[model samples]
Target: MRRSLPVDAAPPVAVGRGEAYENMRCDVCGSGERDEELLLCDGCDRGRHIFCLRPIAARVPTGPWFCPACAPRSKPVKRFPMTQTKIIDFFRIQKGAEDVEAEKCGIFQDVKKRRKRPLVMHKKRRRILPYVPTEDKVQRLKQMASLATAMTSATMKFSNELTYMPGMAGRSSNQARLEEGGMQILPKEDKETIELCRTMQKRGECPPLLVVFDSREGFTVQADADIKDMTFIAEYTGDVDFLENRVNDDCDSIMTLLLTEDPSKRLVICPDKRGNISRFINGINNHTLDGKKKQNIKCVRYDIDGESHVLLVACRDIACGEKLYYDYNGYEHEYPTHHFI
Candidate 1:
């Protein structure tokens, strides 16, 4: 038969931090002690030491039980794998140092003291140094400007003389003669260099668009959409804050979709297969977008993930040959994980 404890009845063996543990004295074994021992609970929160309880060990299951005297100990939780362990250790050490420093200062007390002083130094007697202008001599300045103007006129005349028709705009037979005299203008074309320049111009510092397929048979396409071609059109997208902060991580928070005008009446769906569509979208909005929905826009395509899902974008309607894109957001990410393809 199952049993339930009386609501008003005291527990058989309470072994942690609670009103019963707090009020009940450690010395009296029923009355609580005035100076409760500070102990960390299994969850790493503030807890009371062990020796305060009546029986000293817990049999009660309902309450958060941690001995006030000593930190509650449970079997160590499994740790991350070796690579992750190293990363954790590195960060933990750095954080531990910060904690130690913070404890010493006693929570912004040092900050207050440091902040009391003026950030910029003030001078009692502000001495004025006499300014010596570069163009103090009017005649010299005029002479220099006249020389510059004359030189520019001469160069323009020479350049006009060198101008040629379509295929050979800047190239001239005189270029080889000038090269021997240690002068070089535009470089001779190398096929590899020309191709590299073209690639760089096309990519334009915008990251390559990533399309991940969990299963091999997932439908994928590389095509841009005109306004009419897009089933669902979300205009004016991308996070201003993300751009401002230079955060380019895959998991970075983004601007929420401000307007969800389903012109095509396409069903807005979530990537999560198990949860309700609205709830999943809410979760993605709140956590991923940082809850700011402004001019940023996004579109949802039902079958993209083999489930209903939304895709984020950049503002402009891409050209026919352009790559499809999604914002790869991140918040305080590590190096290797945030690597570009």
Candidate 2:
């Protein structure tokens, strides 16, 4: 079902740049035309036009109106899990591929000629080569539980990181994207942040982060210490698949991966089955008061070697105990926040 649109086909919806409208628009219909009838949700503060509501209302309510999902005592009706493995077998991972770790860590061009080396060949780095995870068993389990909780509402298997199923892109094929002009090498500035993250992952050094359950947001990630701006937090790991195929996919945590000029080559990351803390990080309802301020973590994409990796970086200095939030729709404003957790 998922395949890229032909080049001559109708234009697709914009994916990035989720900018809200100038006037408060209806969250249900995504329109600002009917100004007077639009009512703001008391809970999330998103506007909803009266006509968009079921059984169309004649006039706006008095004071403190809430959406159906945000109504008092209203409960979330969770749906069946989208765990069918057979439905995603349209793509296949390239065979005899390079190991994934090397693809993630390696980004150097081969040197044809060698220069004379100094007697002391040692090099220096700001952070250690590999990050070491805390040895505490309780903390490790806590991290695992956070990942597990991402899909707990729908009953899904837990994954600490992204997993490549048989039909997903293989390391070698992903690496070939550079030659095909579909991806670029991580810039020097971008490389530093990602390298730090990789070192932490290599040494199993867990970030000073934790996943905590929020009655309103299901599960959310938080900073355990004061984190600096541009500090790499975690990569959005998941099953990489074509976007066209997932048009009807029931997974809620799917993220856009690579969007190339060629419509047939679009890719998306489905984290329902396997992902880390990034999967648990909730999206900001931009219509709320904290919608803009609540986003402490900025999601960034990088092309390391030939593979694409999505990283969650702090947009600014984060104090201890602050929860993390980001714009799920990037800049497009397409992803909806209609269903409250």
Candidate 3:
């Protein structure tokens, strides 16, 4: 059923501004036109009027356009070279099957008897049954259910720091602080904040702790010390061209952070491949096992004097030692498995 067009017998003519135009009649309609409006075929030098072509045009095309005579013809494609014996054997098998089916139907006898009833070929009916779960599949489901129960219990135990208070339905303390500060918060410490604080604490010279990393809960940014929201967590800096080349080559496993939504921009942070402690921050699924909603942080675009930055902002109050998590896909329920590290 497959067919292929033959390769062009003639080489394509290079079309450029300085090519010489030949004076000739329209090969399609056999009409001659001396006007500059006619388009000359790059292959045969045949002239064609703007209106005479199948697709009537208003102007010359940007690229080379060939005439019908100059267009390549299609040739029947043979995938494999066939022997004469193989061809004869194929036809013989087909003819034999047809003859046997015809004889079994007895079309000649029905016509001789002057029967007018249409011939009907009754086909055997087949019933399809629903798939029954295997014993292994059922056992797997039970194991998954048990795992979900355990994870739910563990999550609740670790999340006790986020105590619920009346009248604060959804707003966290950090969110309230952010609202009071006009959505922008000044960084209290520079890039060496965590390292300096750790070093100072080791020398018994530091203020109350602001954040800590728990083995089970990852890094938790606390709001106990009037810490402002929209804090600069950490950043991954790399060559924009190198990141683009990696993505172009389908090496997207490292693309963990989306710095910009605009394609024209070239700012993508890939912390999964190389990053600081912030990369250890986990992401929440659409729904937890306990059926409670849980997104704590958000990635926001922050511009600093013409340079772009992606900042992690606390959308709700995060308690001390509470795990930090954000929706990786921006939307709930839609999980992109391939993009996950």
Candidate 4:
């Protein structure tokens, strides 16, 4: 017989091949070899297909001898979640949970957060008023302010009283003269000036609008204009005694219009003898001006005594129930007048 292998020593199992009959460890779950039907796994060297080994091995490929645990894990995972998606979803869920927790706390946190936010608003400034006098009583504070407007300008023509003859062309000519000579309602630049004044007044500072009018037109008197020999005629009321004081002290003779109540229920003030300069301060008071029909006009007059006092005229005619323009001088403006819903 050919030289036989020794009983004690069959060829030593190659280190790479593993010992003969020494079962290969299962790659799946590291379970020890239990089945030997499938030949050694190429990867794990176990004697069974990987499907037989681990909990998830049923999902792994069979036939190819691979450790069951290893096979399932090695299969390419499908449907991996995107990083951004995962993060957003996680945060959303976290927020929901927190909301639930907040609800359980018995305090309405959402409502509380809303309430905690302060109601903020933008408030337009109220113009500071020329002091309402408590002493000397002039009248027609509103009319005075308008008459003192620097923007209203007029051109006057010298015509004798004969020119005012009623029913004569003289009267018509006088009418034309009045139209041309008397203060022609000057185009008002007041909106801009008022806006600027409001901006300044907001800071608790007084900013006056100084304007210059051409006296060549009608007798022009601005708020800051100098007064010399002008006679100011204003209307009056025995009622509202408090107003008398304001006129005496706070009213400036040059800048104020005297208010007078007439039987017609209208307030009339005259800057000069010429009716052209008469200011209807209390048109609204008498219902000559309807406040409901238009909101811009109102009856307001500050009474004071002086030849220089100018009657304030309404930019628009007025009616009753309108807010008087007495406070046109200037007032304090507060920030955030209202809260946003």
Residue pairs with backbone atoms closer than 3 Å in model 3 (clashes) = 172-317
Encode model 3's per-residue lDDT on 89-110: one tens digit a residue: 3222122334433432453354
Error of 2 at 10 (Å): 26
What TM-score does each of the candidates earn? 0.17, 0.55, 0.30, 0.16
- Alpha-carbon local distance difference test for all models: 0.26, 0.58, 0.36, 0.26
Better of 3 and 4 by TM-score: 3
Give the best candidate by TM-score.
2
What would the per-residue lDDT of candidate 4 be over residues 21-138, giving only the tens digit for each residue? 3555444345554443233543644454323332212112222333444455553213213343442332221223334333323333433464587777867332212211112112
Q: What lDDT does candidate 1 reach at residue 63?
A: 35
**Candidate that beats the other on TM-score, 1 or 2, i.e. the better one:** 2
Q: Looking at model 4, which ten-residue stretch has the lowest summed lDDT?
A: 332-341
Judge candidate 1 at residue 216 and give its lDDT. 20
| Candidate 3, lDDT over the whole model | 0.36
lDDT score for residue 35 of model 4:
43
lDDT against true structure, model 1? 0.26
Q: Write the per-residue lDDT of candidate 1 for residues 1-341, one digit (tens) a residue.
A: 00123345564454564564345333323323433333234343333323333322212222344443443553332332334334223222122333433332442364357458776776542211111112223332332233223223222111101122342212222122222222222222222222232232122211122111212211112222232222222222221111222222222123221112322211111111111111111111222333323212233322211222223333444443333333323221222211111
